[model samples]
Every structure is written in C-alpha cells, then in structure tokens.
Target: MDSANSKITVLYEAPQPEEYLQLRAQTGLSLKSLDGAKIGLANSIFAVILRQEDKLIGMGRIIGDGGCFYQVVDIAVDPAQQGQGLGKLIMNEITTYLDIHAPKGAYISLLADVPADQLYKQFGFDYTQPKSLGMYRLIAL
Candidate 1:
C-alpha cells in the first residue's frame, strides 16, 4: 500500500518496554518480565519498526556489548501485518546498523524460531550446525 493511503512509517526508535511487551505478545514472541525488559531494552544498540496509524505494526532490535557480540533479537510483526515485508524492513535497518558499527571479527548471532530461520537466511545468516549450536535456558521465576 502507498504511504499516503497506508500511512505506515518506519522509525529507528526503541519502543518503550510496555510497547515492546505488547508487540511481543501480539506477534507470538515469548513474553519477558517487566524488570528484565527494562534492563534489556536499556542496553539495546538499535531498534526499528513500522507504525501504521500510530499503531506499532512491527519491531526488531540489536542487543549486546557494542564491539564483540551482537545478537539480533525481538524481531516481531503484528499478525495482521505479516507477509507485508515488515520483517525484512526491520532486518534491513538492523543489518545496516551492524555494517556501519560492528567491529571486524565481531560475532553477530540470532536464534531463529524454526521457519523464521528461512527469512533470516536471505540476509546472510547461516545455520551454525556442525560447527556450533544455539542453546539457552529459562530461569524459573
């Protein structure tokens, strides 16, 4: 849809923790504790999203130590906005930031959720299998 008609805009701004939580829930991403979200979002290097009619339609963020490690995280789009390329729009902004800022030899990584990995591959992300595997644990609250 055309901008004049859709009024969708992408911005390089981090959503407030509440907005982030809402988008995560709407987009089927796992929920985060409010306290954890505050610390995590405070440390994010970059975030981008699409907004339509003042509603957050999609969002993504880069979080890590500035130089050595960066993890692409919290990539999400409103269910109604999926298939509209909003996810790619989010990734393009994120990778552009990385190209400009990440140091040479810096390790950038993400844990893609099943089929979503296919979307990431288009942007040069590869499976780490055989060489390494992604692992994680959820702390009991």
Candidate 2:
C-alpha cells in the first residue's frame, strides 16, 4: 500500500478514453462506448487514477449535476495489479476531494457491486434500502 515502495503513482485526474475502456474491460466492469467514455470522463467532478511506470493500474470517478447530487462511478483496478490496496488508494483521494469540494447539503452516492460494496462502506457510504431502492435501465445510442 506504499507508493514509495513501488513504481506505483497516484494522479488526481481521469485517464484517457482508451485507457478507461481498457481498464474497465480488464476489471470486468461493463464496457462503455468510446464516445460515452470521452464525454463522461470529461465531465467528471472528481477523478483519481493509479499508475505504475506510466501505465494505468486503477481509476475511480465522480460525476453529477454539479450542485446537490453526485454519484461515484467507474471504479476499476487492473486484474494484474489487484490485491495491492490500489482501490483503497483511489477511494482515499476521492473522499478527500468530496470532503473539501462538496457543499454541506450535497448528497454523494454510489451503486456498489457485491464485495466492492464493503470497500465503499469504509468511506462512510451506506445502503438505502426498504426506505428506498436503487434502479437502473441502460439505453443504447
């Protein structure tokens, strides 16, 4: 978990569209179109990237309407580089940004998947079930 001990580097910016798609595929996240990747990445409210020797190893981003609503998305780590605490490193940077930039009334949220939900919970995220539920349906262009 020590960047100083390895070639790993953490950057406070989103990766290029191609890298985004590659990482998502490597991590088994849903594939996103190139156009969607470019537009979505450019619109990130906040993003953190992990790199090793100039190669992207992990990434996470926050996108929203830029006022009161925010959602964390695109959290992915390269399969070859998993088990090194990179995911936590990305979340640390993200939570730091939110703590400073998010307004007092802002409600930041994320849709966690299975075991990954455990990681998000460490950053103060909680499930809103019974009282409310998360729903989604994808559309194609």
Among the numbered candidates, top lDDT falls to 2
Estimate, for each residue in 82-112, the C-alpha lDDT of model 2 and write its tens digit.
7778888889888898998898999999999
For model 2, the local distance difference test gives 0.89
TM-score of each: 0.93, 0.93
Per-candidate RMSD, Å: 1.6, 1.7
Candidate 2 regions exceeding 4 Å error are: 1-5
lDDT of 1 by residue, 1-141 (tens): 334348688888888888889999987888888888888888889988788888888889998999999999999988987887778888998999999999999999999998899999999999999899888999864
Candidate 1 global Cα RMSD: 1.6
Residue ranges of candidate 1 with Cα displaced over 4 Å: 1-5
Lowest summed lDDT window (length 10), candidate 1: 1-10
By summed lDDT, the worst window of 10 consecutive residues in model 2 runs over 1-10
